[model samples]
Target: MQHVRVYTDACLLFVEHKVSWDDARKSCRSFGGDLVMIKDSAKQKFILDSLIFEHWNTQNIWIGATDKAKEGDWRWIDGSQVTYGNFANGQGNNHNTRRFIFSDGSNEDCALIRRSDGGLWHDYPCAFGLGSLGYHYTYACEFTRSGYGTTIGPTNQTGSTDISNHTSSMAPITSTIETMAPSTANPNIETPAPTTAMPNVETPAPTTMANIETPAPTTLPNSETPAATMSNIIGKKRRL
Candidate 1:
């Protein structure tokens, strides 16, 4: 349930449901606050008196103080040391046996306010009794009043810090543009294939044997002078 009360410098939210200490703190943070931190006696009294008025029948309510970081070195959720404390008699010793272990073997690391003990503090198992142990109680949340507009109230549909109407200038954009798409240009250059065929023009070289051989001898008759010379010489001798 969404119920909140405003005091001097803080706003307290009382969640009337059972949850683990961690889950309780997370719920409070979801609404921009955290589990109530009772740092000093004045804050402690404010919490207790407020719980009394809440009328929550349960005796336990998760607080912000814990020793989860280091055993026996208790500190609030904000990392401030617990200089002031109102732990019940023999309470902050982790457990009854003082071995820092509960009956279920879980460590007592989270703090809570017990209404039965008039809002005194105790270190309890952070996750025990949340499940089968059947231990159930509610938790309270506190938001600093100074952070009212920027970090308070449930989230809205328009995603603005303010609760009522989101300012038009602060309204979130409906669509987003992609600025990192893959490039369409190719990364490698294309190379042409090499030609394999010989050239079309032939060389002037004559490869035939007949064209290269010498001319054959001519069989024409001998010249007439060789034969006439012999006959003419015989006829002249007889006449003489």
Candidate 2:
């Protein structure tokens, strides 16, 4: 195993170590970090320049980048998809293969880099058993910005100014939060019935008419004259 230290003042990231791919990853994780991913040419160069000339015998070191979660969907272990990588010429040809081999005979899927006499990037495979520079591995590796720095924040030292500026440049979100309130504060109100009252029934009076009778006159008075008397007698006979 071989170990080396690399630092960047601008990014405040420190990378150090050379261990087996597994051990290197474990070491980074033990410190609550992970192997570094070189996102740009500048960063790649910085790592390369930091290494000693002899260390460049290999092509590169295993990085904390892989697509093991989903085949062909290459991404870092932190769930970040790789937008930039430092693959050598005709490298990454074995797309479906699990192992990544550099120009050197070392077999590893991930690795870091340092420059050789020719000013070209070289790969250093992660070794498990050998011990060098406090790292029990032959290949040198680096830790990500979060892994190396004391404070785990954005790699940019401008205090996320880029993100803020981008937010200001873009249009604001149009969506608004809609708060719904009950139509009435009290839900117990009941509707009133119709105002018209029902009609009352009246009983008819009983019939009160009674039967009546008139007694016939018992007698008729006789007249003073004879004729009158005769008329009275006839009237009496008629009555009887």
| Predicted model with the maximum lDDT | 1
Residue 187 Cα positional deviation in candidate 2, in Å, after optimal superposition: 92
lDDT of 2 at 186: 62
Per-residue lDDT of candidate 2, residues 1-240 (tens digit)? 223233442221233343566686775566455666666666555555434322344543456665544544556667787677655543332333322232222233343442333333222333433221222333333444333434332221112212211211111122244579758666776889877977777878888778667788878787566545788889999999
**Taking the tens digit of each residue's C-alpha lDDT, what string does model 1 give over 1-240?**
434555556766777778888888888888678888776676666666555554566789888888888878888899999878888876764344453233432366788888887778876778755322534568888777665443333322322122212221122222233579798988888878777887799778986666666778878997666555778999999999
Task: Give all candidates' CA lDDT scores.
Answer: 0.67, 0.44
Best by TM-score: 1
- Runs of candidate 1 exceeding 4 Å displacement: 93-106, 128-135, 149-240
lDDT score, candidate 2: 0.44
How far residue 49's Cα lies from its native spot in candidate 1, in Å, is: 1.5
